[model samples]
Target: MNTQPSALANSAGPVSGDSAAAKSRVLQIDRSCRLPLMFLIACSLVWLVAGGFLSLISSIKLHAPGFLSQSSWLTYGRVYPAAMNALWYGFAFQGAMAVALWLMCRLGRAELMGGKGILLGAFFWNVAVKLGVLGILAGASTGHSMLEMPGYVSPLLFVSYCLMGVWALVTFHFRQERQLYVSQWYLVGALFCFPWIFTAAQLLLVFHPVRGTLQAVVSGWYGHALITLWAVPIGLAVLFYFIPKLFGRQLHSRHLAAFGFWTLAAFGGWGGMHAGAPVPRWISSVSIAGGMMMILPLIAVALNWHLTARGAKGPENNQVFRFVQFGAIAFFAASLLDIGGSFRVIGEVTDLTVFTTGVKALYLYGFFGMTIAGAIYYLAPKITGCDWPSDQLAKLHYLGSVVGILVLVLGLVAGGILQGVRINNPEIPFVEAIRSTIPFLGLSTLGGLLLLAANLAFLVNVIRLLALCCCTNCFASNRSPAGSGPAAAGANL
Candidate 1:
């Protein structure tokens, strides 16, 4: 009785009495959490657009240093980190929080009853991110890679995170359903583990100010954990839940899933050592080994997703599947690329270079961003019961994202490798080496522009949907919603 009214209605012609009841209960869960989740989504969208602009600025600055050189607050040192934090903390994390809460409620077969706390927490989280970004721009940063926010900001973030995160755990704990899905495992783990890691990093690196290179070690550990244990798990949870649910199939293998989960949990945190970290040899050795061992988990997860998606399910939500398929491929590819980077040769050359930027693009925008984009599309219709207003816009958004990321990643990866080679070669002057990469930087700027355009399209699409939900049909049609088929969902992208 995993009820999805629009998804189910799109695939199948009719629903039984049980499905009708299930849909009712599901709708209750959706409605219970609607305000907070939608508020989060809305807030996240703003940050996404704002981040895109900041990203565009940063990208332009790479190739053209004189564009906005007058403003100290807009310098690359400040703006780059600000853009990164905005997207990571503001857009990605908020979207994940909303999606995670919805999944917890759905899997638990319970309403998100106490939602005011979540809304309040989300509000505070936004305020924290805003103030934190301002701090970074105004030169009050703590100077850590991921933890750039001022020390004062971390506590508020932690408290707000706990507010939203605790409710998700409560929902999971009080689940009406006895059996927990694979997604639940990842979500629950991500929820608890991220806070633990974040808190530990704050204590050692920020509050206490660790001595010597140990500070770098802590920062590296926190950065890696942010993506690996926190962001990746949240992305995977959505994929694991949606792929099976959308395809109307059970997960391919429980054993494989268990193996994947444990492997990731065990080996994932053992990472964080840089190419030539000043830490002990054994530390880097352990990290490299852990990364190499991650191949097993990657294999398990990839196989499970592939096997689960092999079956037939009529004209599925084209938009949903398209995004998921791309995201799944990106996830696997990024994981492989990341593993490859663990080797000495690749690590040495690519360390602190734009090649690493390519990997991040693959991970952040390609995998997590796209998955969440699809989820937003799917969830929007379900939550608001409004058919998409425009297919062209949706397709445009997808195209821009896909093409932009490809161009951006390719430019950075190729440019980065070239830059690394020049840096390593004694004959090449350092300044000359930097100059040679300008062409590639221009290419990335183009890609950034495209991504910015794509996000703007998404914003418009969402606005249109809101208009439909609030006006026109005026929510009357929302109550007893009309069906949405492949044609209706269209190559909604």
Candidate 2:
């Protein structure tokens, strides 16, 4: 320090060798974990396209009720539930399982255990989702928002999830790494919480439907926890992995992560129960207070990631970076909407309007969708042993998703506010309020199509990548490459 000039050295702090070591480790991990990642991407694209189409139909019906009213099978109620089933079970659940498998392997530093079992679980899960969606289309839905699939489907889903959870847990158990990573904490909690929450919610809602306003309250509670238990954990797991990996550093605030995780566990499920209804004043007030309190953990998470990435020039090389960046931003926005929607005063006007739909879209598409998209991007190159077919294609996918979701959310919000104003105004006819939403609904349909197009392109890219993997030249080129293993070839999904 005495010999060195102040202008020539970093004054903030010394860059530890550990930071460099962490960066190298992340690069190595990314390089090794490829094949399973690609399969996850393929599944996500397929479900997004299916979900987008359903959303398209639902949005159109809002403006023109007669568009698909002729067929009982295609009615809005059936179509909307079926669409959600596709997105939730088909897209989100399946995709998260794949990502969870990969992340556990990388973070736990272990190879996947029971490859055949994992594939079998995935197969059964898909079969369950397929039958469940068909049931919804046939008017056999449980008539609840998140638990729409008929009671029969729950057993199949339960079996499938249990099997897959076993694979992930066992993989974590066998990892060579001595210290448990923060990502593993969330991952373990998620895998454990899913079966418990899902079984209980299904039992209560399907087997013993609660009466009156309590039913709505319980339904909202289940819906909120469904996302919290399934999507939020995965999103947090991804954040824990990518931020540290991309920035070539350990989480700057591991203590902060633990606090945030526990806080979410304590508070997340209760806030959504305030979705509608004039519950006891104190009850509604507590729920709103809980929603507002979520701001702390949310901010903690954002800071944890941001601090890790503080001085990094850019993220690591891959498609994963593109998808994850969008997801991180969406997570912040989704949390803000949650807090906003929690207020009873706000809900009084927006409760039945399109704003509720917009809130749903923000959580599903904006938050969970983006994370899944990023996982796919990160996994494809690792599995295929070839760079993404085109970086431009990756950019297009993320851009399309962001633009599409924003447009759809904005259109719905604007329309919802307009509808609320009209409904509240005694001077305006109800038809006039309903009619005003046409333009906004029109905008939503356009956004849905845009999202659909993006998903199609993503699907095509994945298919092409898989084709290349099967190619004689590509297979030969990858045969003896670094980090390739039976797990890569055995992905089988």
Candidate 3:
């Protein structure tokens, strides 16, 4: 029941003159990073569309191989990897970076410095992702699951990440706030851990390939670390920041928050190896134990969020609150499924089929993607000094996204179970197994279409908002008094 030092020291309080100045500085920092963040978000949206297209194609090829059999590039093997890489690197990572940068600035209570360098880094990061996706399509992939990008492209990504990481570190070091909140801990840990984990994986898996099953071990570790250490923390940071703010309350339990963070850090790395690779029995056991242990942190987080939001009213009509709530539920559900699937009986059936894919989609789209969307919805108006262009568009996006992800998860889970059962029974014809999956695959494709439509609506709304901000800035700058141009323009924006 004792609170951690960070939790006790970092409690929110009333604003004073110093705090008011900090708020002003935060606004300036946001303004400085606005363009770069927008660029990152826009690239993410574009990649979402591209990934969606490739996903649909890949899904279709599963049931109807002859649909795009003419082109070698469009073959199922290449297209599936391409779709995954585009979503993981292109859309997910970019959106995470945007969210992370904003959180770092706000929580650190520092004005953003080195904006140009971060901007340049973001540009090259996108370039590397683009080249990596193209290389994957061109059959230059290194055959590693998540690290499939060619050897040549890895350095570009690593260097760009280092550049971005340095900016984050520098900002953290110079932060005006002395006591770090839970969100800052998550944000800092994720930023620092990513480069290390990624570089090690690249070196072991790509630069100097590991032998045999060790490569699989490293790949599993990398994939898990990417989600648990990087993506999950980013999502959690946003949730931790916004939940209390929206609900007008303090966090439910600081002690629980501390416990959750440390426990997750301890167990998440080992948990990823449970994907039933052919490594060793002890490895799988260790992973299963890790996965089971994860339930503690998951329960801790769920309880904390629920307690924080208890008695909160009117959030259903708010876009940001609604998205975060949905994301929270998805995260808890995904965790339960992950733990359940770690059992030998379930893992035997689910690990090698589309069920695993469903779990992953639940995390990436339903959890991380939804939370990021909420953060964007809440922050965009503040950053641009303009409200959302249309509430109707936001409503459509929310509905489509929730419906699409639910349908996709359900279809994959049901189909994967059937496929797993058929595969285990060697007497069943492979053709029949394939035939059984056709209907579910079709449903998944429909769900994907709905998601794509939602993303397009979001992208259009963002573009309109950005254009308005740009026009406002220009008009304000031209009419500003001498020596006050920059200040006046910023005020208008």
Best by TM-score: 3
What lDDT score is found at residue 28 in candidate 3?
67
Candidate 2's residue-wise lDDT over 309-344, tens digit each?
787855546567767777888888878877777777
lDDT at position 419, candidate 2: 85
Question: Each candidate: what lDDT?
Answer: 0.82, 0.74, 0.80
TM per model?
A: 0.91, 0.87, 0.92
| 371-478: candidate 1 lDDT, tens digit per residue | 998888878776665788999999999999999988888888889888888898889999999999999988988888898899888888988887776764444554
Assess candidate 3 and give its lDDT.
Answer: 0.80
Candidate 3 lDDT, tens digit per residue, 1-493?
1243334323332121245665565566566556667777878878887997898899878777799899888888899999999998889888888778777767766555566667788889889989998998999988888899999988999888887777777777777777677788888888888888999999999878889998888888888788888888888888888777677667888789899999888888885665457788798888888888888889888889888778876355789989988888898888898889888889888888898888888898899999999989977776666788888899998999999999888888888888888887888888887688889888887788888788778888888888886677646674424223224323432
Misplaced by over 4 Å in model 3 are 1-26, 274-276, 314-316, 478-493
Off by over 4 Å in 2: 1-40, 275-283, 316-318, 472-493
Clashes of 3: 0
Ranking by TM-score: 3, 1, 2
Candidate 3: clashing pairs of residues = none
